[model samples]
Every structure is written in C-alpha cells, then in structure tokens.
Target: MTTLHQEHTAHDHEHGPACGHTPVPHGDHVDYAHDGHLHRAHAGHYDECEQGGHVAHDGHGHAHGRDCGHDSVPHGDHVDYLHDGHRHAAHDGHWDDH
Candidate 1:
C-alpha cells in the first residue's frame, strides 16, 4: 500500500477556485495542481500529495506524448497524459495512472 504525504508546501496562500490552480479529485481527496506538483489540504496546512509508487495499466495500448490529443499535466518530475477521465504517466515499461 502507498502512504499519503503529509508534508506541507511553502505556499503562503490558500488553494481553491480563486487560487488559479485547477482542482482535481483524487480518490477521497481533492488535489490542486500548482507549481508543477499536487497539493492537498491537511491539518491547518497543506500536503505535497505524493503517491510514491507504480501502478501499471496492463491493457493500455495507446502511446501518449506530444500531439497525442490529450491534455498534458505537469507532475513532480515528469508529464502525465490525460486519457478518458484520468491522467497517465509513463513508467518503466508501461503507463501508470497519476
């Protein structure tokens, strides 16, 4: 199982609709994609929202990249391609849902 990151970010502002960062529903929580990373609200602060693991989509067939007709999302150190209703990030030998 993956553990949720409880580390807070250095942002001095709150994130919401007026914060300019898009809010995305991630499982049971909401994550805001800002500054090239995902942020989640915690106890009076914010968390980095890191899901540090790999979950490969074994039946995915399309190769996503430049001009793949999907929205691009900037993750921590790489890019994720939006497919269907979720984000896909390229991993070791397959695509991992971001």
Candidate 2:
C-alpha cells in the first residue's frame, strides 16, 4: 500500500504604506482572500500627490490609468494589491480547494 500527504504552506508578508501613501481600510473596497490569507482591498486606488500626500480614489469616478505608484500584483487572470508588502488575491467564492 502507498500513502501520500499534502502540505500547505502560508506566506506572510508585511503591510505598510505604499508609494508614501497610507491605505485606509473602508467597507466599500473589495476583499482579497486566498490560501487562508486575507489581504488588502482590490478596488482601492491610491495616488501620490505633489504635496507628498496620498489621494484615495475609492474606485469611484476616478480613473486608474495614470501611474499612481500603487503596489499591484498580476495574479492569474486579474490584478491584485500589495498592502504594505503583502500581496492580496481576489476571492473566488469557492472553498473546495482549501
């Protein structure tokens, strides 16, 4: 008889200000959760201003075409955010793989 074991490892990344802009957690932002890790929001757009302050777009009427110096990661088919130093993934609404 043969047996096999599967091991899952979780990667923890630091969370801090990105591009000199501090991320404020809101209720309207999208949640990114994957592999039992919950990261920052996906729709949160932060832009660096000339005054050295961050302007949050809140994924509303503001467009995300300009280079705002936000930390983002291309995961599989979509783009996620890097809160602080941690990469966040969008939730797929399925827990079978867990």
Candidate 3:
C-alpha cells in the first residue's frame, strides 16, 4: 500500500509607492510625505506612511529616520547617510537572525 500528499501556497502581489511602477491609489498627483512615503494630505497630496503626511520635498530626509536627524534611508542591518551632496552606507557591526 502507498499514500500520497499534496501542498499549495499563496502569494500576494500588492505593490506600494516605492515600487515606482504602479499608479497612486487616487489616480492623481498626490503629495509624497516628507519622509519619502506617500499618504493622503492635500487633494493632490498623499498622506505619510504614519501621519501628518507632507509633500515629498527634495531635502526632507528619510521616512524611517526622519525624526532621527539623519538624511538617508536605513536598510535593515545598515544605515545610509546622505549629506554634502554625497551618500554613504555603513553597517553598525551588528547582525540579527531575523
């Protein structure tokens, strides 16, 4: 005698503003939050990923580290810094299993 088993998996294809390939949910020129994320703010401005979303200005800074005073995006294990018209990425010498 023999037995058989089957398995199945599901995947989600949702995309966000960062994807840069999809249109904004409202289908108009929405305000990109000062932090880099887009959310509902003005009729043509989107809100932030959190709250009080503002237009994504050229020098507002990172979305995650906006309150931290850093002008770059943090990519998990490392931090990216942008200043003086230059950009750099550095690791804090720490790693996690996650």
Please state the error at residue 88 of candidate 3 in Å.
1.6
Worst 10 residues of 1 by lDDT: 1-10
| Structural similarity to truth (TM-score) of each candidate | 0.77, 0.23, 0.21
Clashing pairs in 1: none
After superposition, candidate 2 runs with Cα above 4 Å error: 1-7, 10-59, 82-98
Residue 58, model 3: Cα distance from true site in angstroms: 26
- Cα deviation of 82, candidate 1, in Å: 3.2
Per-residue alpha-carbon lDDT of candidate 1 for residues 1-98, written as tens digits (9 for 90 to 100) = 26476777567879887888767677777778888887888787888876667778779999998999987778878987767666788988799876
Alpha-carbon lDDT, every model: 0.79, 0.32, 0.32
Q: Could you say which candidate leads in lDDT?
A: 1
Q: How close is candidate 1 to the true structure, as a TM-score?
A: 0.77
Model 3 TM-score relative to the real fold: 0.21
- Better candidate number, 1 or 3, judged by lDDT: 1
- State in Å the error of residue 1, model 2: 43
Collision count for each candidate, in order: 0, 1, 8
